[model samples]
Target: MTDYVSTTPGLYPLPDWAKDDLSDLKGHQKHDLISGDESEEITAAYEEAREEVIGVQQDADLDRIVEGQLRWDDMLAHPLAVHDAVETRGIVRYYDNNNFYREPVVQDDLGFSGDVANELEAAAELLEADDDLQAVLPGPYSLADLATDEQYGDEAEFLGAIADFLEGEVDAFPEHETLFLLEPSLVESAPEDGLDERASEAIDQVAGATDADVVVQPYWGALEEKVYAHLLDADIDAVGFDFVAEQDDNLYNIQEYGATDDVSLGLADGQNTLVEDPEAIRDRVEWVYDQLPVAEFETVYLTTNTETFYLPSGKFEAKLEILAEAAALAEVKAA
Candidate 1:
């Protein structure tokens, strides 16, 4: 088993109180709000938000800690959207959610300047248990799915370019125990006929760039059968299911195809504000074990179906506490 972890998908909602102060934090780096005067204040806001998010992980007794990605705009497009090689196009729906993100229009060859790696380093500086660190990024297939691809006109070429771009970023990621490649498009907008292999290969290309165990977590729903099979074929260390949104399909897929030795179960509802009872969460975990033949899995992570940023900060923090309490009740070693 790589490790036991209780982690959110990593795009956390900025607390209501901090929203105004930190809303422009990402803008500073994007040069959208490049007032050199706010440089000290920007650094102060990021540090305070990092401490708030990481402190909650500590309070929940989570084994893995994230930087909360407080400065990220969205998972898939932020890296590309902010790149000099890409343009921020009009806003588009994020998967099937009510939320939206600016579409990234690629116009040149992909490049990386250590954006995520820098965030991971900032997060590491605030952590005492160094190995407990984890990082998150949007996976390649989804990044391609969610963006406009004029640079690489061909489908496979576009996917490969995005993968190559992410691979470069992964190579620069600070040392961490786990890396989550969020690939909601795999479930939301299934790949076209016979393209599952291309998608899987593109994913593995980026996963290969990192030493950290990679968990390719697809959410909003479950992947189609072939997509799920191909995803399992990738060089991933684990996979996460949106048990809240597509429990039947996800459960059926696991029973049919089995699973990697490390699995993440998205038992909590990421889109809702109401917190679930820890006992109910534990019951869900035990129920899976009773229903499936997955006892061989080295670690079973308890996480949300999608990123928790959709919820209010207080509700998000409550969800974190629920995860830890439930993991403890289930006696899962990692939480």
Candidate 2:
């Protein structure tokens, strides 16, 4: 049976109480807090919000749960931006989305800051002993692409440095059974001049540093054939394609390029406000199964194409319900 996983790529919208708690600091601000000191109310809110998300996941009977990255200051770039060797610059648009992130400027040699590991640790503490928790981070190539490289003059060198830094970060993190490396930039700005080998090398190094099963998820849209084919050569366990954005293209890519060791079917639309029908989602999953050469891959993951952080809290919950229902229906039909 395919695993139904929740991928929290970035900041999940804070619940009302959590929003109210952080009102004193800055509510829905585009930038990170100048001071890292979080109030008691905000701290409690984070804990409460986590418990609620976990409860929802448990009720939905999801195979795996994500940390729901409620504290991401600048989306995927926050962790890298806050490093001692990096500095935050002017606000910049986050890809094609309405969301924005402070541009990360690499001031010197990159290093593991342990900020992400600490954040993951807090989330890990909240999980039950039996819970299969997944930790997420921005992929090295994507992070290198996002940041302004003032230190490393060469693009490949910069990517290597960032990958090594992430390798250390992954090593520091608590033993996560699964780790997701979000690689949106690879698809968003498909490097046409053949950076494939370098990207694959960087991804392999970072993925090899951890004992956990690593999945590299490229959201936003479908990757070009050359890029997608090269990505499969990476050392990660699975690759997640954005079916919500370009379902036909993604499905075709899988048919043409062939399957990876495993695949993540992103059936849920993350950015849409309208809730998808459970039956419709189930039908889509069935269609995907028909198209895919299932025996070629080890496993499949049913999940959102991107982060659920784009949706309102209510709609996000509804999407989860949809996923849970669809998953259950798929199982019954298979049986």
Candidate 3:
């Protein structure tokens, strides 16, 4: 059997350092020449912010580290890396102008214009630099939901292609204990009609493509039994449930699901300023542990639902401190 492994809940809450770095680039016009085709100031700021976020995570004794998503802006700009891989396009629509930095949506059918192998390689390098790090990527479901569907006619086809593309990318990662987290933020918005079926198929395609332990993580709302049931049947390594948003129901669902495959306990609030009480989180974890073997419980991870809800850099830092303290307390209790 694999050794027991534990990781912090994904997204430890943004630190103030992150927010400050973001603010510096907030008003800068995209594609504008701030410094010879790229804004050196923005680049430096992001690098600094990423380091700060990573530092905080390390200090917290987190078993896995995220590159602080400082490269989020850069990643968005390169959507074509993942987008073009699947054929279809039109202007990609933003879920909300508030969440994303870019305004233009793809106006035609999406197609891969360049090789993303380099991008994936760079990301892997960053993750590998940290001994305890895992790479997170946007799942195909969310990509389909976010893409402009004007030219694609059907989102299902686009999603399937994207899944194939993702599988290829996952296979490219260097061998390590690193886990790849597939965050499908749009799963919550899946239509009640036949959309759930399409989403499930797309998820399966991606799950089947990767060798690393995969976690199909959805946040912001409760996962309907119809949707989650499919994940339970998929070959995924684990399913991450956002308990912070829908605690009671999600917790119960996890208890039922935890009996089978691994489950991630999303107790940390990834989007809010409210500092979580470590004791309370531990109690909840304990409640779940009571229902499963200690080895099974090791599959559980503590994390936030998403990372888009941070206030600013300073506040983000404070939040990380809080999370670390709470997690430390929980570790003590667990030991």
Candidate 4:
């Protein structure tokens, strides 16, 4: 028997009004860098949006809930970008997509400042049980690969340093059921000849940081055989595969390398505007489950192939609704 879970892997889509408020806030920051001007209206708007998103997840009857990551202005680079030891460099295209983010430029040794931990805690306050919360963060490899490193000149050394920085962040994290490490860079820019092990070591560093179950997901496409093989060696509880962009490679890797007790199936197309039928999503889950080498799965998560931040809020909502319904169907069949 396999347990089923449902969650969005990255920043949930923001309401149109919240986006306007955020844009205005950014304009204010750009106009006057010295002023520590905080917008109460924007804060209120964020709080409202957060509450609404939580309500949506609850309405969908999801097994696990993410804080929606609505506070993320820089996506993966926000925590590092806001740190005193780092600076925001020019924008970089995000993984061949129509999106962009300000890359974090690390100038000194980094430490956790509870940036995301605070966000997670806020979500915790609204939930009935603390155990239902799940947190999402950029995996160590993606953060280091996407950023501009000024301090550590060595490649491997910088890789390990990012791991240590993330460890510090999760070391300060509040109690939760799971943590999702988004590592789209692994699929977009595959590791070199011998660096796969180093990347895995870096990932395992953060995986060992907290008590929560860790899931490292690579999206934007499927991973190569060697990359997938090395990733399975990591100490994390599960590895998620993108079934939307590149399904065959992902399916092949699972068949050849086997899988952990738990696995994440990215059945929804996050970037697309169309919403999948709930039955279709459920069928895909069962199909993937049947291909698993193991007799039973400890857990199988229903997720988007990648982040849904680019999709419209209405469509994103519909997708989650579909995802939850699909998960319900899968659970019933598994039972």
Best by lDDT: 4
For candidate 4, the TM-score is 0.94
Residue 286, model 1: lDDT of 71
Instruction: Please provide TM-scores, in order, for all candidate models, with all chains considered together.
Output: 0.92, 0.92, 0.75, 0.94
Pairs of residues clashing in candidate 4:
none
Candidate 4 lDDT, 148-250, residue by residue in tens: 8899998899999889988998988888899999999898888997888889889988999988889999997888888888888889888999999887788
Question: Residue by residue across 152-232, what tens digits does model 2's lDDT show?
Answer: 898888989999999999899987888889899888877655687788788889999889888888998898888888888
lDDT of 3 by residue, 18-110 (tens): 455556565734322221133676666655655656666666666666555444442333343234323332333334334443332444644
List runs of model 4 lying over 4 Å from the truth: 28-38
Q: Candidate 1 vs candidate 3: which has greater lDDT?
A: 1
Candidate 3: RMSD to truth: 4.9
Tell me the spans in candidate 3 whose CA falls farther than 4 Å from its real position: 1-27, 30-41, 74-98, 101-130, 175-187, 191-194, 255-260, 289-296, 321-335
lDDT of 2 at 186: 86
Candidate 4 global lDDT: 0.83
Q: lDDT for every model?
A: 0.82, 0.78, 0.55, 0.83
Selected candidate, larger lDDT, 3 vs 4: 4
Best by TM-score: 4
Worst 10 residues of 1 by lDDT: 28-37
lDDT string, candidate 1, 235-326, tens digits: 88899988898888888899999888889989999989989999898888777777787765787788988888888888999999998888
